[model samples]
Target chain A: MRSVSKYFDGGDTVANYKLDMEIDDGEFVVFLGPSGCGKTTALRMIAGLEDPSDGEIYFDDDRVDGTPPADRNVAMVFQNYALYPHMTVRENIEYPLKVRGVPPEERDERVAQVAELLHIEDQLSSDPGEISGGQRQRTSLARAIVREPSVFLLDEPLSNLDAKLRLEMRSELKRIQNELGITTVYVTHNQEEAMSMGDKIVVLNDGTIRQVAEPQELYRRPRTTWVAKFIGSPPMNLFEGANNDGTVQLDGGNSLPTTAETSSPTVSLGVRPEDIALSTEPPDTDWTVPGTVKTVEPLGEYVLVNVEVGGSVVNVKVSHTDAGPGDPVHLTFDPEDAYLYDENGELVA
Target chain B: MSVESYLEDRLDRDVDGEKLTAILVFMLPGLTLFAIFSVGPMVYSAVGSFFTWNGFDIGQFAGFETWVATFQDDAIINWSNLRALEYPMGALPQNLIWMLVHVPLSTLLGLGLALLFADLRGRSVLRSMVFLAFTTPTVVIGLVLLFVYDPQAGIFNELLRALGLEGQVRNWVQEPQIAIYALIAGGVWVQTGFSMLLYSSALAGIDPALLESARVDGAGRFRRFKDIIWPLVKPVTAVVVIMSMIWVIRIFAIVYAAGGPSGGPGGVFSVLGLEVYQAAFSTPIEYSKAMVVALIELVIALPMAWYIASMD
Candidate 1:
């Protein structure tokens, strides 16, 4: 996709923008965002299910943006699987080859190949309703792969699966993508799933692209407050701050260094829970904010301490220990780890 | 502070829970009507069939005599046990003939019209126009068909005459074999309107995602409907078939109005509906035999409805 924009009724209001997303051969890039963020809309544009009001999409230099879904040579697994209820597993997987007019012998071979890959070979004769939920998900994936399409598009394929199945499918999907070497675009609102499965995750918000980077890069060095806040399980904490000289200052005497040249202006600061350190006495350096402990939420591996400081709350990840409610605490972040944000919620460069 | 008053405040004004009230209020009138009309009539027939009775006189206990006399009648009477193969075979060929014309032709034609009309802008008007035929009195349909099928004055025979095919024209309702077909055409005119409406509503519920899935899978239009559309619409098909069967079996005024209660010349084209009428009100009322006929109609309908309802 290169500068593709599809407007509902020709730009009467909201214009859905899907930018130039170059998927190199065999790259598994995921589109991650909340609902109505045009993530699925962008995927539909790639699959030729929707027409772009402007710009072009190319499959290996072939201008295929206007191609019909069947002609696009792309396979898609829907969130609901969208399997043909009346068709048996074999027939569902064999439909694309049947469409291509492949002879019977080769068609059966291809069906067997894909079904075996997804471990649904035993389910070939059964109807979709007869299979288990996980089996249906595998069948849907096998149906997509059987076509041997040039690329794959998965729209929240594992979202309907239970937690255990989702985790299992995440690894299974990565393995499949590695084996097939097809450029795939997977869209989901599940941050953990995207973090685990995506080679490069594109974070989108409100029909606009925010950040596109490798999973860890996007997580650790998010370009904006929105990206930081939206990309984690317990989301990165943001605190209102002011920029003065070479430091970003919060309430009390706490301050962090900023590379922003025009440092005289105030700015908001963001810090992840993992980056924030908590203690009883103030840290050796004077760069710390004081807060009263509000609550501690124990999440098996670690305890999340929610601390209220100057009308703003920051959650700190700590080991489960003697922490309790109604305790006064000192909170601090590494100066380099502290992120400064402009007034418009953009990362201060 | 005051626990006694707080407990009293929670004590109650709810006579019945909402779900119970809603169920009783929603279901009562329909159940009452069904009891009075459908269930009550069947109970009346079963009880009445056992009596050596005229309409006014419930005579001595006849026991199985009514059931026996029903079948052994010179003209075939109600044989509920013999109802199975009676479909394509049986002396009462009217029921079979009615189904033969009405089921396949009305269903296919109605579905075709519904598919075409769904995307049309003036669909509501077109749908209402067809339903206008269904809503018209059965006597009107029969009268209208009578003129069209009439040999001398009817427009259809006149058109045949204009085309120089004089021998092709006949008094449609009076002819023995053609009478069934002529009556069926009128029944079709009414029954088909209903099929169209059912099909239209069913076609509306076809999920649009199904089309996308098929398209992605590269299924041709015909293959899509064969694999996906057909199964999804199966329930709708069942509903339309049962409803049409009920209407076709219960129908009386149309065929009688078109071809008269005797159902054409020698009663060769007589149907179970016409048989029920003739047995009840003919010169010497075989009122018990008419009860047998009504019971036969019920027997024909119940199993089919049950079977269709059981389908997933």
Candidate 2:
């Protein structure tokens, strides 16, 4: 993909929707973003379903910007699973091969192979409307996979499944992509799914690429404040502060010492929930601030404590907390784990 | 609670007085009009089919004799030449022939045009142009057919002459052998637009994603239509067939206009509707036999009507 932008029917381009990225072959790249962020549009342009208003797309060394979708050799699984309602699962899976004039015997063999791979062997004879949503999704996957296309495009394919089924299919999809070694572009808004399944996650906001990095790198060092807040569950807590020499003073009167030097007078500080700890007494340590515990939520494996520091509230993830609401505590973190962003929300340190 | 009070509670539960009044107010007018205008004539015709009439008065009770006369009438059934399409031909077989030819031709042409115009750049203009024929009155269509199919000075013969096929040009609506086919061709022109509108709307309702998926699956345009568009629009085909069948069976205006009250040269263009009109208003006015032909048309149309009603 290269600076691919799309304009709809009335000639109005999607605001800020420009993409420029090179996805490695056999890589599972997830376009992660909120709705209307143009992730699906980008995938569609690559599939040749939608043409870019300005910019060229390449498959290997060939420019495919004007190619029809069929000649592009990209198979897409729609969010609704778009199975042919009139065809049986076997027939649906065999449709591509049939249309390509592949012999009937080979078509049947490929259909059976994909059906067994997707665990939909028993549903081959049933209509799509008669099957479960998970079965329908698997049938759609079988249809896309049976053809052995050069690239697999899935537009929120797992979104319509139930929560448990979605979780199950996430790993299954990743495993299949690993086995097939097909270059895949998956679009999704679910952050956790992107974290678990993608070889590299591309975070998008307001139709522009915010960052593209490995999931862990995206989590440990977000390139921007928007990505920092978007990539994690409960989100990264961001604070506005004034940078004075080597120390940053938060607007709420909390201060943290840092070694990075920046010319910006004001900055935004970010810290993940898990990176912060709660101490009952004011810890005599660097990067510690006094606060009062506001609320405590206990999950089986850990507890989430909301602590109020100055006029702002920050969530702290801990294993166990003896303190309840309204209790005084000190919030502490290593300065190295903390991120600093300048006035424009770009990460400076 | 007392027994009377319990009964009153059950009545109150079953029917709300205000809701009943509102239902009656909304439904009564349409129901009354339908009964008086539609059902009333049907019942009158059915009963009149069993009686003998002397112009304005009921003459005598002639039960099966009137039915026998209706069946033996040359205009209604033409018992002598049962299957022939000649002069003194039966209206029943002519109507059937019309339905068989006109319905399929119109439906196929309509579907083809709808698919052709579906994605064209200026599709709405083309669609309106095709659909314009449907809006033209059938009587006007008949007159236009007369002018177009004229053997001497018509555009059709002129084109045939220009193509050097002058040997094939003849009076299309005057010869009994080929006149029914000519009228049927005219019927197809008038009916295709309605079928096209039906199919176009159905085609619009399909999921575009399905087609996109097929396109990615390597299906070409024709394959996509055969595999996706046709199956999806099948129910609409059924509707168009039933509607066209009903229209051709009772068709009167076009045939009557082209052939006049006597059913044209050698009565080749006669249909059940024309038969009913001619029988009831001829010099002697055989109203009972007219009612019998009308009843037969109703019976033939009833199954289609029932099928359409049950579709919902």
Candidate 3:
């Protein structure tokens, strides 16, 4: 997709910004964004479900924007599965082949093979409504893969499943994509799923791309504060502050020295909770700030210590500690982990 | 007594008399209306079919002789030509043939129109224009169609003449062989709108993503309708077929108005409903024979209704 834009309500409302990206062949790229961020819209344009209001789309070297969805050779698994309720699982999987006039024998063979691959062989004769959600999802996937299309698009396919099944299907989807070697574009609002499954993750905000990078690269070096806050579970905490020379002053009256030099007078400081260390004793570092512990949250593997530094609350993740409310603690973070953003919300350093 | 103890005693009873009274109070009006309007007439008609009585007098009990007369009457049934099955040149046979032709033609045309107009701009306006015939009273439709099929001034013949096929023009409603077909065409025009609306609403209720999935599966428009839309709307199609069959079987007003009250020409377009009306209200008033025709229509319709109900 190159400079693709979409508008709704007769070109008055923009749905997608000028989105430019290249997905390589056989790459499992995930378009990650919140609702109304045009992730699904972008996927739909590629699948020829919706026309791009501006710009062009290409499949390999051929321009495909003008082609209808039937001739596009792209398979999409809708979020609802969209299996034909009247058909048996086998018939549903065989429909694409049947439409293309493939012979009955080949159709049967492909249906059987795909059903077995998805572990739904026993469910071949059952209607879609007769199966469980997980089985229905597998059936939908079978229908998509049976065609062996050039690109496979999935719009939040696992979102309807229960938590355990979603995790299980997430890996199953990745495995099938790897085995088929089909170019797959997955759209998801769950950052964790994107992080675990995508070869390249495109972060979108307000219908525009924020950053496109590998999962770790996006996490380590977010291009903007929005990407930083969106990509993590306990999102990076941002603080209003001013940066001068090599030191940045926290709004709560704590000044921290940065290794990276910056000249911006007004900046926002970001620190991931896990990167902050908490200790009962004063830390032997120039970056330590003193605060009174306000609350303690005990998650099984790690504990979150919320401390009141001056007036702002900063969360610190630590191994099991005998810290409680009203206890005084010292907070320390590596200067490299500190992120500086100018007033415009763009990363300065 | 204390409130809790009072409630416990109430709960221990097998029936709550006051609550039962309240429920019956709410249900009685609707049940009584249904009994009076639907069940009462059906029972009265069934009972009247067994008796020979006029509207004004208590008459003798006639057994199934009236039923036998339906098949024996020369004007109703003649069992000479079995190959064409026209031997029974009766109201019942004519109505059956009408059902065979009208139901499928109307429903298929309606389905086609629904598919054509579904996503088009000004769909509601176009649909309303097609459906205008349905809203018109059957009597008015019959009269309008009567003029359209008039031998000299009718638009159909004029169009045929303008197309240079002057030899094809004929008396549409007066010709015994083609009069029923002319009436049926008007019937289809009215009924097509009904089936179109039924199918259009059913199509609208379909999950759009399913259609999108079929498109991505490389199924073109015709294949999509066959593989997806047809099966998905089968229940609605069954409904349209059964309703149209009933309408065709009970068609009297249009046939009476378009073709004459006496079944067209030599009674070639006569139907069962018209026979019932003629037997009951024509000279001497053969009420028993009218009941017999009505009962036969009821018997045919009951099984068809049952079959459609059992489909899903």
Best candidate according to lDDT: 2
TM-score of chain B of 3: 0.87
True contacts kept of each: 0.60, 0.85, 0.95
The stretch of ten residues in a row with the least summed lDDT in candidate 3 chain B is B79-88
TM-score of 2: 0.83
If ranked by DockQ, best first, what sequence of candidates would result?
A: 3, 2, 1
**Most accurate candidate by TM-score:** 3
Ranking by lDDT: 2, 3, 1
lDDT of 2 by residue, B1-312 (tens): 974455456665665666656656888899899999989999998888888999857777888788898788777778666664355567887788789899999999999999888889999998999899889999999899899989888898889999999898998899877888888999998899999999999999999999999999988898998999899999999999999999998899999999998788767778999988988887789888888999999999999999998895
Off by over 4 Å in 3: A1-13, A259-263, A280-282, A290-292, A308-312, A321-323, A326-329, B1-65, B72-90, B147-171
Q: Indicate the worst ten consecutive residues by lDDT in candidate 2 chain A.
A: A3-12
C-alpha lDDT (0 to 100) for residue A242 of candidate 1? 77
lDDT by residue for model 3 over A1-349, one digit each (tens)? 2222222211213667778888887888999999998888888888888888777777766778878998988899999999999999999999989988899999999999999889999999999989999999999999999998888899999999999999999999999999998888899999999999999999987888899999999998887899988978678877777786778787767787876655668888788889988889988898777889999999988898889987888878888879899999888888788788887778877
Per-residue alpha-carbon lDDT of candidate 2 for residues A253-333, written as tens digits (9 for 90 to 100): 777787777888999889999998888977888787778889999987789999887788888889988999999998888
Better of 1 and 2 by lDDT: 2
Counted clashes in each candidate structure: 1, 0, 0
The docking category that best describes candidate 1 is acceptable
Reference-based TM-score, model 1: 0.76
Q: What TM-score against the true fold does each predicted structure earn?
A: 0.76, 0.83, 0.86
